[model samples]
Target: MKRLMLDGPGALRWEDAPEPTLDAPAQALVRPVALATCDLDPAVLQGRFPLAGPYPFGHEGVAEVVAVGEEVRTVRPGDKVVVPFQISCGACGPCLRGNTGNCAAHPLMSSFGLGPLGGLDWGGLWADLTRIPHADAMLVKLPDGIDPITVASASDNIPDAYRAVAPQLAAYPGAEVLVLGGPAAPSIGLYAAGLAVALGASRAVYLDTDPERLSIAAKLGAEPIEGAPAERVGRFPIVVEAAGGSKALIAAVRATANDGWCTSVSVQAKDTALPMLEMYSRCCTFHTGRAHARPSIPHVLDLVATGRFDPSPVTTRTVPLADSIDALLEGPVKLVATN
Candidate 1:
């Protein structure tokens, strides 16, 4: 078997590796059908993000179950499923509470694809085959008629976007959403904007300086603002900070309406500035963390199945898995590599 390995920034190569087997009763072996890059992958590949390398290279994907252990009942051979990037045991305390990203059964960052941060050699989806533990808990079987390419990002970014607004929109029905997008990984911000509209936001306004992203957001049914956000953007009840910059983060935090929720999906490697006084005065809630992807994937899939949320528009292009290395290094807004 062969797997894509990231030697370092801008340094990706294919290397031979032993095929993964179903080593546990709760495990399953899958053949990736469609694979997508996580929001930070492009940055990591270009050396824009600081994560070190020498790890298997991919995390988001939908796959076909080729084999399953005796204990895996939820899915069987030939079933198509979405694989969450994070590793977790369903029986663990954190997983029971829906915090699968922080599952206690493994190290804090146990997951796929990510190098040192991923915490284990669980392998990457870019390979011809991969092993999935806690199969019943981690795999979300794709609904009938759903294309694997459309929901390939359900493994991570889509749900990461879904989490930014779903709960807040539910809390404040018909409220507006504001997304501050930037050059750094625009897909999450775009997804959030689109999902806000699909999930019943009265208005989903996307602010970004990039014309391409603004146009995509508009096509996704959001009102696009083609520039940076001001100190506040009309007090949106649901605000998402997907633009990976301190200034954008501050603007996103300040834009939260009184009692509103602002979620930052950007990976802030260092302590950054925020409008503490403004946030305090507004009494807003600020949330920033790695998404607990498993719990949110079902809802995202349901949305895709019902024709409510379409992730295809966000996908800049789809390439054969054989060409994934070059396509990934080139880094479009969202790229899907199929087997």
Candidate 2:
């Protein structure tokens, strides 16, 4: 099989690799039917973060269960499933509390496509085949009649977006939401905005320099704000920073309402100064952590199945596995590579 490997910063290559098989009772062997890049991949490739090279290069994909171990009964061979970015064992304490991202039974770090995790740098789904651990806990079967391309984002982006707004929904019902960033065509932001609306948000504002992305946000019922940091303006009770930039981060904090909440999905390597005095005075609550993808995947998928959310519009292009690298390097929105 062929897989995308990161040789160094701004460097991506497709190389031959061994096929993956079930390595444990809770594992399953899956053949990717479709895969897409996360919003953070390009930034990591550009060395904007502390990511090291020669690692697996993708973390989002939809696949078919080709085989499963004895302990895996939730899904069977031929079932289509969404694979989350984080690998976790279902029985752990963290997992029981719906925190699958920090599952304790797995390796201390088991993230896909990154070496920071202490486990086998589990390569991403930008390949013909991949291994899924704790199969019953990690894979979510796609709903009947839903396009595989549409649900690809559910593997990571959609769930991550949902997590960004989950903590704020109860406190600020119908509160305004401001999303910062325009990656994978403002995918993370757009998904979150849609979720917020579904959850009864009164308004969802999206800020991005890209006109195309802003247009998409508008179509999804969000008010689009365009321009640079100086030109962009808005104040919201819940702000989500997905832009992955220092200026965007600062703007999100500055624009948040008093006693508001700001959720950050962007990963920045550089140190950023915060308005501590301002935040203190305003009584703002800021939360930053990895999205517990596995646990959130099911609910997001159900929403998609019920027609409450549609991620298909975010896909700008779809290519074959052979063109995965090119798809990763250039795209304004979601790009899927199919086998």
Candidate 3:
């Protein structure tokens, strides 16, 4: 099998690797039929994250079940499915609570791809064949109506955006959402704006300099604002900071309305000074963390199947496996690399 191996930052190659076998009774072997990048994948490619080289290089996509474990009943051979990035057992305490990212049975940061985070070693999804453990919990059987290439992000980014804003809308009807976004955040920020509008937000505004992102947001019914995040003072009741820059994070915090909630999807390592005083004064609630993608999959998928939430606009290009390594290593949000 040929897999995308990351030798170093911005360095990728097609390497021959043994096909993954079903390693456990609950595991399954699936062939990647449609591959794409998650929000953090681009950052990993550019070396922004502390990832050592030589590992499978992607974690977003839908797969065709080549084989299934004896215990796996939800899906069968030849079934196409979406695998969430996080490695979690649905039977765990945290997963039962809809926080699959923090499974109590695994290491704190247990996940597929992103090599060796805290000593957990699951390979990437950019391969011909890959193993999926806890198949029933880890895989979402792709519905007949959804396109695997387009909904490739359903494994991570699309669902993350759904998780970020769906609850907020449910909690506060007609809420206003402000997405402190940039081109680096990928389609996630745009996905959030689209979800907010579809889920009944009073107003959804996307702030960014990228014409492409802004155009997508506008097409999705969001009011696109062209400016720097730091220059904005519009206090939104619900704010999402998908831009990984420190300035954008700070501005996101600063723009939260009193008693409002700000959810930051950016995964940054360095510390940046935030407007703690202002946030404290306003009694604002701020949250920064990894998304719990599995639980939200059903709702998001329902929306996708019904055409209520379209993932097509998120993808800029679709390439074949032979030419996918470069696309995986660089440029454009939501590049769909199909088998």
Candidate 4:
């Protein structure tokens, strides 16, 4: 089997590797049919992230169940499914509480494809075949009518964006949403804004410095603001910070209405300062962490299957697996590679 291996920053190659086999009755083997570039991929490839590679490089995709172990009953050979980025056992205390990202049964941050952060032993979705433990718990069968490419990011980005807005909107009921977008997780920001609109937010306003991001946001039905405002954009009950810098995070926090909630999906490698006094005065709730992707997969799939949400517009290009290396090097907003 051959898989995409990240030799170093901006260096990748197709390398032959041993095929993965199911070692446990609860495990399964899958062949990735559609792989998407995670927003973090470019950073990892470009050396912007603090990671040393020479490991399998992808974590988002839809796959075909090539084989299943005896204990796997939810799916069988030939079933198409969304393989979550994280590796988690569904019976742990944290998983039972809906924190699959912090499942007590696995090492902290045990996942696929981020090298050390995500266990290297688990490999990546860019491979020909990968093993998935806790098959029924980790794999979400793609709904019959949904296109696999449209929800390729359902494994991570879509669910990350979904968490940034859906629950907040549900709690606030028809309130407006504010999305701060830029380099980090750009597609996630667009997805968040789009979900807000599709889920019935009174209005979804997206702020970003990049014209391309603003354009995509507008196409997703959100009001696009060209430049970052000097002060608060507007008081909103739900604010999402998908932009990477401290400036954007500050803006997002300050822009929240009294008692509002602001969820940040950005990755900041260093410890940064925050406006504690303002948050104290505003009484805002701030949340920032890794997305517990598994539990949200089914809901996101339902959104796509029911025609309530469409994530296809965010995809910048579609290329076959052979062309994935070039597509990944180009680093578009969202690139989906089909096998």
Candidate 5:
């Protein structure tokens, strides 16, 4: 099998690898039908995250069950399923609480592309076929009537966006929601904003320096605000920082209203300063972490399947698995791999 391997910063290669098999009684072998890049992949490839060097390089995808382990019953061969980015055992304490990203039972658990969690580095989904542990717990079968292309991004970005906004929905119904950044973040933000509106947001404002991204936001029915931090602050009740840049984080913090919530989806590798006093004075709530993708995949899929959410407009391109690196580093919107 040929898989995408990280060679170095800004470098990707297609290399031959061993084909995956049913590794455990609860595991399954899935051949990817559609795969896409997450917003953090480029940063991880550039050595921007805490971990470094060539590993498997993708996390988002929809796959067909090629083979299943003995214990797996809910899914079988030929089932088209949405695979979440994280590797988790559904019975873990954290998973039971809906925090699958922090599942306690899956020791050393991590996705195919990312490095191992507790010293077990594994390859990612950018391959001909990959092994999925605890298949029943990890894969979500796609609902009927959903386009594979449209829901490909839901494997990560869309659900991530949904999680970024979930915590804020109850506290700020019909409040103005601000999204910061471009690319995946803004794209996810747009989906989230649409969800917010459907759930009753008064308005959704998206800010980004990229005109093209802002244009996409506008197409999603969000008010596009063009400018930098200084030009766009103090306007939204709930601000989401998806840009992964310090400046964007600052903007989200400043733009949020007093007693508001700022959910940051960017994976910041370095330390950043925050307006603690200002946040304290304003009673602002700051939240940031890896998105609990597994738990949210079902809800996101439902939204896409029912036509309540459409991410096809945000899918900028589809490339073969061989061009994974270039597609990831250069695409404007979501990039799906059809291999």
Candidate 6:
């Protein structure tokens, strides 16, 4: 088997590895049909958030089940599925409460492409084959007609965008949403903008310097603003900070309305001080955590199946799965690599 391995900062390559298999009663073996890079992949490859050398490298994918273990009843061989980024047992207490990202049955960072974290260690999914533990709990079956590109990022970004804005909209229908988008996790912010409009937000405003991202947001029905995030006006009730910098977070916090909610998906490699006093003054309900993708994937898929949310437009580049490592280093907004 071949998998993408990060040798060091700004280094990536395909490495030979043992073939993955159904190692447990609830596991399954899958052949990745399509793979997408997460917000962290580029940084990891670029040496921004440095990790140990030669670690397995990707986390998002849509795959075809090639084999299944005895207890896997929810899906069968030949079914195409979306594998959530987090590994969790559905029976765990935290999982039952919709907090599947930190399942008690799995160690911290118990996920694919995240190497050696003291658990049933799995390698990257950007390989010829991969293993899926607790398949019944971890996999979401794709609808019959859904395109792989359409649901490729559902394992993380799509569902994440759903969670970030859904609750706030539920609390305040037609609420305003503000997104600070940049190089890191641009799709997340773009997705949030599209979802806000679809869910009846009074206004969805996207602030970014990238013309490509701003255009995508505009096409998605959001009002795109081109400038620095700090150069903003009034406050918004719902905000998503995904630009991945201290300034972006600061700007997001400053632009949030009093008693508003902000969801930040940026993986801050280093600790940076925030304006705690300002957030305190606004009574802001700020949230920053790993996305619990499994619990919300089905709903996101339903939205895709019913023609409400389409992730296809976000994919601006496509390449063979074998060339993923090189494509990633090139750094396109939403690149999909298929088998």
| Per-residue alpha-carbon lDDT of candidate 2 for residues 214-325, written as tens digits (9 for 90 to 100) | 8878777778888664345667899988876677777888888999998887766678898889899988888776788887888888878898777776777888878666
Better of 2 and 5 by TM-score: 2
lDDT of 3 at 121: 65
Q: What is the RMSD of candidate 5?
A: 2.3
Write the residue-wise lDDT of candidate 4 on 101-137 in tens digits.
Answer: 9989889998888898887888999989999988988
How accurate locally is residue 290 in candidate 3, as Cα lDDT from 0 to 100?
Answer: 79
Error of 3 at 49 (Å): 3.0
Cα RMSD to native, each candidate? 1.1, 2.1, 1.6, 1.0, 2.3, 1.7
**Any residue pairs clashing in model 1, and if so which?**
none
Overall local distance difference test of candidate 2:
0.78
Candidate 4 has what TM-score? 0.98
lDDT of 5: 0.75
Write the residue-wise lDDT of candidate 6 on 35-87 in tens digits.
88876777666777656666787778899999999989999999999999888
Better of 4 and 5 by lDDT: 4
- Clashes by residue pair, model 3: none
**Pairs in steric clash, model 2:** 181-243
Ranking by TM-score: 4, 1, 3, 6, 2, 5
Question: What TM-score against the true fold does each predicted structure earn?
Answer: 0.98, 0.92, 0.95, 0.98, 0.91, 0.95
Question: Candidate 4: how large is its RMSD?
Answer: 1.0
Give candidate 1's whole-model lDDT: 0.90
List where candidate 4 sits over 4 angstroms from the true fold: 229-231
Off by over 4 Å in 2: 116-119, 183-185, 230-232
Candidate with the larger lDDT of 2 and 4? 4
Off by over 4 Å in 3: 118-120
